[model samples]
Structure formats: C-alpha cells, structure tokens
Target: MNDLEDLPEKNKIFESDIFIKILTSPREAFKFINDYNYEKHLYILLFLAGMLRSFDRASTKNMGDNYSIWAIILISIIFGGLFGWITYYIYSALISWSGSWLNGKGNTESILRILAYALFPSILSLIILIPQIAIYGETMFKSENDFYSSGLVESVIYYGFFIIELILGIWSFVLCVIGISEVQKLSIGKSILNLLLPAILLIFFILILVLLFKLIN
Candidate 1:
C-alpha cells in the first residue's frame, strides 16, 4: 500500500502549500495546479479580485452624491464578488475557446484554476488599500476632493501606495500569463495571444455592431 507522502502531487492536494508558491515561484505553482487541479480557494480569490476591481472603478468613476463610504465599500464587496465570480467563468470559457484556435490544450476549468491563483498579488493590493481608505476616507474615491492638494506628505503617501498597488496589479498579469502558458502547454508568445485574443475579438465585435447600428440609423 502507498503511504500519504508516496502519493502523486495530485493526490496530495491538501499538502501542496500553494499560496506562497503561487507568489514566489509561479511557474512551479502553475505546474502543480495543472497537474493537481488545485482549486481550494477559487471562490474567495474570485471574490477578492472582484472587490479590488470594483474599488478601482469606484475610484475612477465616483459613486454619485448619495452613497456613503461605508455603503460604497459594502456594495463593492457584495456586487463585485458576484461580478467577479461570473466574469471569471466567462473569461475562462473565452480563453479556452479562443486558445483552441492556436491548437492549445487547456480547458475552461484549468484556465479558471490558473487565473484564480494568478490573482494573489492583486488580492494583496487590498492590504495597501486599507490604509489609503483610512487616511483619505471618501476623498480617495471622490473626484472633487482635490486629493493631491491635501499636503505634500499626504500626496507622497498616496502616490506611494498607488505605485505599489500598480506594481501588484502588473505582477498579477505577469502571473496570469505565466500560469496560462503552463496550463495551455504553449510558449509565452502563444499564451499571450491566447489571453489577448478574447479582448481583441470582443472589441472587433463591438465595432462591427456599432457600424451596423450607424448604417441602420
């Protein structure tokens, strides 16, 4: 009989120690995921990614005059989690479907696992955001607040956090590309194409729709 330690990595999913691995050695992490079908934290990761995305949109677009900061945060977490869950599945499906055109091997489930793990850095950005919200309050999300004019020190801190968050976001994308490459069994170039093809096709479809609408009008 085989002992627990003698089992293959797939059978030892509970012992994988993937969270730290996903950040430090993403290629190996992705390889384990592809091999083991690791998906224990999928929902929470998707929810957090959604929340971060919602907060980003709120910062840029503002939440109108009626919402309080607490309300905004609450709404962002709940709705963003739902949106993230839905979009994660949609994106995985799109990537899988599109990648097949390049003779790629990954399916939607594998793509979903890759992306869920890839979101670790972006999720860490939430740690950076906590202090920004505490320091700036609603001004962080408001366009009329003249945020930078608060003080030189304040501006420096805000911008510093922003840069850190930006780096984490960029690193998240890097991880995604690396994870996709492993899952799809493709070169980095093809993995990038697999990732971008969905967006490119979506933009093209939208343009065609707009052209058709103009002609009809």
Candidate 2:
C-alpha cells in the first residue's frame, strides 16, 4: 500500500504460493501496472505458474487421475505456459469485480496469452512424452516409479525442473523490479539483488542435492 521500500523486510515478494501472494494484495499488485508495460506482471504470473507446475509435477505424482497420470504432466505443461499471462486478466477481473466474466468470460488478450503459453508447451510436452510413453508405453508416473517413475535419477531431474521454474519466477521478479524501479527511478543495484536471490537459493538447493545423493547411495 506504501512505497516498495516502506514494505517490511519480510514482505517477501517471492513466495511459496504465488497465487496467494499476487491475489492477496490485488490492488497493490495492480498498481504496479503502467501504460507502456502492462505485460510485465504477466511474466510474473507465468513464472508463478511455472513454479506451481514444477512442484506439482515433481512432488504430487501420487494424486489425481494417476491412472492416466501422463495427463498430469500434459496439464502441468499447459498451466506453466498459460497461467503466467492468463493470471493478469484474472487479477484484473477480480479487481474490477466483474462477477459475470467467469461464465464464459474471455478477453482477446487473455485468450491469446493462454493459447500461446498453453499450446506451445503442451505441444512440446506431448512431443517429448510421446516418445517416452511409446518406449515405456503403458507405464505412468508414480511416486515410487523408479527413473521412469521415480528414483535418485528422477529426483535430480525433478530438482532440475524445480530450479528452472524458480529461475523463471526470479527472472520475472527482476523484470518487475527493473521496470517499476526505472519508471519510479529507483536503484538498479536493488533490482539486481532481487534477481540474485534465486542464485543463492539455487546454491543452497544444489548442496542439499549433493548431500542427498551421498546419503542415498
């Protein structure tokens, strides 16, 4: 509600629940929007979606339609691609109190963003997964499923995906900082630091991974 600097040290722009963080302070977040850079927040939403998709894919292989669990990967891909941009309108609609939009509410910009993110990633995922499915044909992702399903190897790969999603979120936050700071004429160094937060996190997680591998094997 106040200047960015005035927020508490623990206001925590990056968060575990991206939706909650963004949606929690919808008015404050919307104020970040400007005429020239409307799309900036879209990236933040996308990054959030990516993080969710990453975690859901890696951590929640056990839940929901596991019988056709391959669909989970496909759906996650769609969420990752589209939610980033799609969320901006969703945010705006909620802000405007457009209660009717939910019943077949579709804006061109929102639709375009959704189609772009969802379709591309979904297509790419299907491409990659088709081969994996054809090779391992009938098998599906399970928590104890080994390398194809789950294992040390799978853990590493999942970590890799989690890192990638985290990186995307950090990158989006940096862009937000840069745009907001520059227009508001704040320090560039501060923006850089926001981006650097992810690097520190990556190093910490990588260390965990190493220790985990050592323990398991």
Candidate 3:
C-alpha cells in the first residue's frame, strides 16, 4: 500500500533525474534503465505519442472537425497502443534475435521496455505541433490544399516544423542506438548492426518476394 502510494513521487524523481539524461548522457540512462527496470511510465509515454499521432494525422488530412478532441485522443490511444505493442514486440524480438548474432546481449522484455524509453525524443518532437496549430489554424483541419498552400511566413513555419521533426527523428534514432547498445552489452558499432540487420533482411526478403511474383506472372 505504501509503495503504491509512493509510486508517483518515485516516478517523478525518475523522470526528472533520469529521463533527461537520455539525451545528454544516454549511456548512464541505459545503465539506470537496465539496473532499475523503470517500466511504470511506458504507457504514459505511449499515450502522449498517441495524442501526437492523432493530432498530426488529423492536421495532415484536415479532418480535425471529423472527431471531437476527446474522441480523437481516445481513438489515438487505442490504435497507438495496438500498433505500439505490435511494433515494440517485433522490434524487440528482432533485436533479441539478430542482436545476439552481433554479440548484443538483452532479453526481449528488457529491450521492449528500453525501446519505450527511446520514444522520449518523439514526445519532445510534439512541441512542433503547437506553432503548427497556431500558424495553420483551421486550414490544417479543414482542407489538405489549404494546409499546404501557405504564404511566405506560413511556409517558413511549415518548413521549420519539418526540419525540427527531422532532427528529432534523428535524435530519437541515436538514443535508441545508445540505449539498445547499453542494455544489450554491445559496442556502439555492433549495436547499430544489431538494429540494422533486421531491416536489411526485411528489405531483402521483400525484394525476393517481388522477384518471385514477377517470375510467376
């Protein structure tokens, strides 16, 4: 009972003290994550990601009015949770399997949790949406053409957000590499290999399937 009551405070400490380190000092962050296995906030992170995803999708398609804010959030959480679970499991599984061949060391469960931590950068990326909503306003939610057809200042804001997203995406990938490497007991190079191997295999597999289909035709 006491521990449950204390979980929120403890989580606050973890978020403040540890989560920020993920960007500045990822090796230490991964060490802490591996040692403590802080898993409580994963869902919260996923929920935030969901909200961002929902908002982005709505804005991109200009379907903002199609769903109420609460409805959009709720729907996003459901779909995001489903997709997050599947992607996390698949990515973790690949890391566990191929990562081992690269001399990486980590279990599926731990990798999954670590991968959730990697999403912190993505959450930060959501900051872009604020100005996006302000600058584009109803146009973002009403019509795709209107969203893209921006004035000079609006064009600058749009491209600025795009650049921020790109940087954030790269930051997230780097954090994932560092976190995965630390947990898996792999060197950075090998850790990257661990991460990329599955992707390469998938691409190769798709190419083979395409070739076979063409032959069959």
For candidate 3, lDDT tens digit of each residue in 12-109?
Answer: 56556767777788887777677666677777776666566666676666565676544654565577644646666787898899988877778898
Better of 2 and 3 by lDDT: 3
In model 3, the clashing pairs are: none
Give the lDDT ranking, best first.
Answer: 1, 3, 2
Range of the 10 consecutive residues with the lowest summed lDDT in candidate 2 = 95-104
* Candidates 1 and 3 compared by lDDT, better number: 1
TM-score of 1: 0.91
Tens-digit lDDT track of model 1 for 3-109: 44465766466346778788888898888778767677888898898898888888888773457899889888989877867888899999999999988899999
**Residue 173 shift from truth in candidate 3, angstroms:** 1.0
Error of 1 at 111 (Å): 0.3
TM-score per model over all chains: 0.91, 0.32, 0.76
lDDT of model 1, residue 178? 98
Off by over 4 Å in 3: 1-16, 50-75, 137-149
What C-alpha lDDT does candidate 1 achieve relative to the native structure?
0.85
lDDT of 2 at 148: 43
